[model samples]
Target: MIIVIDGLNRHRFGAVLDEMYRLRARVFGDRLGWDVDIRDGKEIDQFDHLDPAYVVGLDDEGHVVAAVRALQTTGPHMLADVFNAILDGEPPIRSATMWESTRFCVDTKRLGRGRDRHSVSYATCELMIGSLEFARRSGIRDIVTVIDPVMDRVLKRSDNAPYGYVGKTAPMGKVPALAALLDCTQERIGRVRDFAGIAHDVFLTEDAALDLFARGHTSVEIETAAHAASANNDTRPLSALERYFVEQMSAARTSDEVQAVIDLIDALPGTLTPEQKFALKQAPAALAREA
Candidate 1:
């Protein structure tokens, strides 16, 4: 599912954002050979600090699979700042109704380039639909994105091709990049939705996101998270424990790792609150009953 993280709820999604950054570091720096700064395995740039809106995609298990960043054109966006070369001699297009979309990437290792529900194609199109819908709702009329030629083709195949080009393509890092424009219109959003066979809402609530991450945490980590949650404000969107659980669970790949989480939850009845207990035990209990 897609989650839009901005300055408003950014604090609640620190771990999620961190994973997205690491994914970018892998895609742009390691795989694509981009000249991006990778400090501590995160690809964070100056624009990330400008309170840009991030449309992040998460799988059923709440692991970040794809993401794209959107920044207001009136501000110091990438088109004007980092990728001015793409604009050639023309001045940067700055307007209140326009936004610059960049850092579009997906986890190629996790998702193969197929049309399956879990493939990179589905994730990529879902992100496109989510980002465009988000921009349209936020009163944005257009988006000028700096993307490589491969991505430009992906957009066309997905039926969400850019309406126009802003400037000539320029050599950027290991590949050439150009600025492409997309109008934030319902027609465009509908085409992508049809292409992806996604009729339901693609957005996930913050609470729903928390619940998914809450499912796979190991018992010891659960106890630690529970303790941490107890110290924080009740009104916080997500507690430290939940965040920690998400970080750990996202990395869990083996059956033993999953069983470790299940075993821990099974053993921790006396420690967790009634609400926490219910949330943590419901899924496992249902599966056990079915078995």
Candidate 2:
């Protein structure tokens, strides 16, 4: 299934986001030898902090297997900033109704080279469908993507080629890349759906996603328990809502992860300080806002 992670609700899907970053590292850095910064096994950059929406594909195990980042063209984006050379002297495309999709990749190591539903074909189409569907719903009229030649061919083979393109192909990092434009419409979504033979909804609710990560004792719970048990006896047990908040942070591996959980906690009525919440993985509240 697919999970949409945005700036507002990223905290709820911290682990899945981490998995997406790691997958990008594996695909672009380890396998494709792309020139990207890989620190601590994650290929993250300034754009990631720009509050772009992420369309992530998760396998049956709730691990991130595919993902694409979406950023509004009116502001800083990969092509406008990093790959401005690819424009070949043409003005960078910038508009409010147009969004930019980048960092498109799938987990080839786990899915292999097969063409079946479990393979890259299905996941790639699903990411396309998710992006189109999401953009259409968000009042976005078009999508501009910066992708390598390999991905361009994959799109054509899947019968979901870009509706149009911009500029000429240029050497981007280790691969030749270019800008392609896709319309955000039902027609595009239907084409990808038919090609992938996917008739079911591809999105999963947050709770369902968390449950699928593990049957019980989520990593957050495990971590919190380990620390709480060693704390002074005066500490009180967490409320039911508080426990749920912490459980969602099990996949977090950094201060950002901890802060994401803190953002959600801020929505819930609580007296928890940032320090207290970080120490115990206690969400500084409950899940109530939209992501």
Candidate 3:
């Protein structure tokens, strides 16, 4: 299923974004040999800092199988900055009705590229359907993509070929890359759906998407998230224990009490998310003691 995440509200979907970034790191940095920034197993860049939208494809188990990022052309974007060499002196195509889509990738390491409905091809097409549908609703007329030749074939094979090219293909890392434009009309969306045999809605409601992730969330964690969201005035949501930890730490009169609270949070079951791990790492005394 496709779960759409607003860049500004990403903290609410931390696990989904975390999986997407890891998938991007693996696909672009390790597999494709792309020149990119990968830190702590996440492939992220300056564009992620901007309030761009993300169309994420999640498997039944809530893992990110595919993803595509969209940024407005009027603002700082990759085609105008990073992939300028592809333009070859032609002016950057910036339009209010057009957005730029980049980082289009699938979990090739997990889903082998087979023609079956359960393969990477389905995941790729699912991501495409989600992207175009999102663009259409947001009043975007088209999207320009910085993609390699492999993606070009994927688009064509899915019966959703780009209308035109912006510039000549140039070597981007290990693959030849260029800019191509795809319309965000229903016609394009329908073509992709017909090709992929997906007639149901691609976009999942926020509550529905969160429920899917909640399957992986422990009851303690979910209860924590709910209470945290209620008490915190800040836009960011905190887990239940995180809020309780803050409350206890605020009342503690001694450093040892704070260390004890840290140790308690670090003892939760299932698995520690990267955020939780980082939080535990910040408590030097607790970390050293645990080590």
Candidate 4:
């Protein structure tokens, strides 16, 4: 399924975005050898800081499989600011109803090449459908994307060919790039849906998405636990028993897991600080409510 992450809901989907960025690093930095900024195993750029919306795809396992970034054309965007070279001598297209779509990618390692639900084709089409539908709902009229010739061909094959081109293609990084325009219309979306044979809703609820990641003790939970466990620089280190309890809580996905930690803590009293004891006591109830 898909999830739209923006500045409004970014905090709740930290783990998902982290995986998406890592996938981008793998695709754009390592595999494609693109001149992109990759730091701490994440491919991020100034556009990411501008509160752009991200249409991200997730597999059955809740892992991030595909993603694309959407930025409003009226403000600073990739094509206007960073990729102006692709625009040649023409002025950048800026409109209140248009958006710039970029960073479109899929996880080829986890997804296969067929048209199955677990294949790259399905994910790609799903992403296209989800993004187009989302843009249409958000009052966006068109999308201008900076993509390579391979992506251009893929768009054509998927029945999502751009309606027009902005400027001449220019050399960018290791390959040539051009700006292509696509209108956010139901006919365009229907063509992609028919090609992919998808009839269900592609978007996932925020809680549902979080639940899927919780099964694996996602990195977001780990990071949250780390922050709580080390809030004081002058505090003494956590005991082995304390550390064990914290680890268990951090990895707890179900009420049963949280209850087990609580039972263990009760059996061995005074093993944790008062604050830690309170937090552990609250874990079971929180997990129960989530369930």
For this target, which candidate reaches the highest lDDT against the unseen true structure? 4
On residues 100-154, what C-alpha lDDT tens digit does candidate 4 reach at each position?
9999999999999889999999999999999999999999999999999999999
* Candidate 4, position 6, lDDT: 97
Writing each residue's lDDT as its tens digit, candidate 1 over 1-291 gives: 899999998876776888899999999998778889999999999999999999999887767899999999898988888888888889989899999999999998888766877999999999999999999999999999999999999999999999999879998888999999999999999999999998889998876664554453334344444444453325444446545444444444444664566566557666655566444433332122100
* Candidate 3 local lDDT, 162-275, one digit each (tens): 999997898988888999999999999999999998889877777567667545433334334434444332445555656566555443434576567667767876554646
lDDT for model 2 comes to 0.77
Off by over 4 Å in 3: 113-117, 217-291
Instruction: Record all residue pairs in model 1 with backbone atoms less than 3 Å apart, i.e. clashing.
Output: 225-241
Ranking by lDDT: 4, 1, 3, 2
Q: Report lDDT (Cα) of residue 66, candidate 3.
A: 92
TM-score of each: 0.76, 0.75, 0.75, 0.80
* lDDT against true structure, model 1: 0.79
Q: What local lDDT does model 4 show for residue 87? A: 82
Q: For residue 63, give model 4's deviation from the true position in Å.
A: 0.4
> How well does candidate 3 score on lDDT at residue 172?
86
What C-alpha lDDT do the candidate models reach, one value each? 0.79, 0.77, 0.79, 0.84
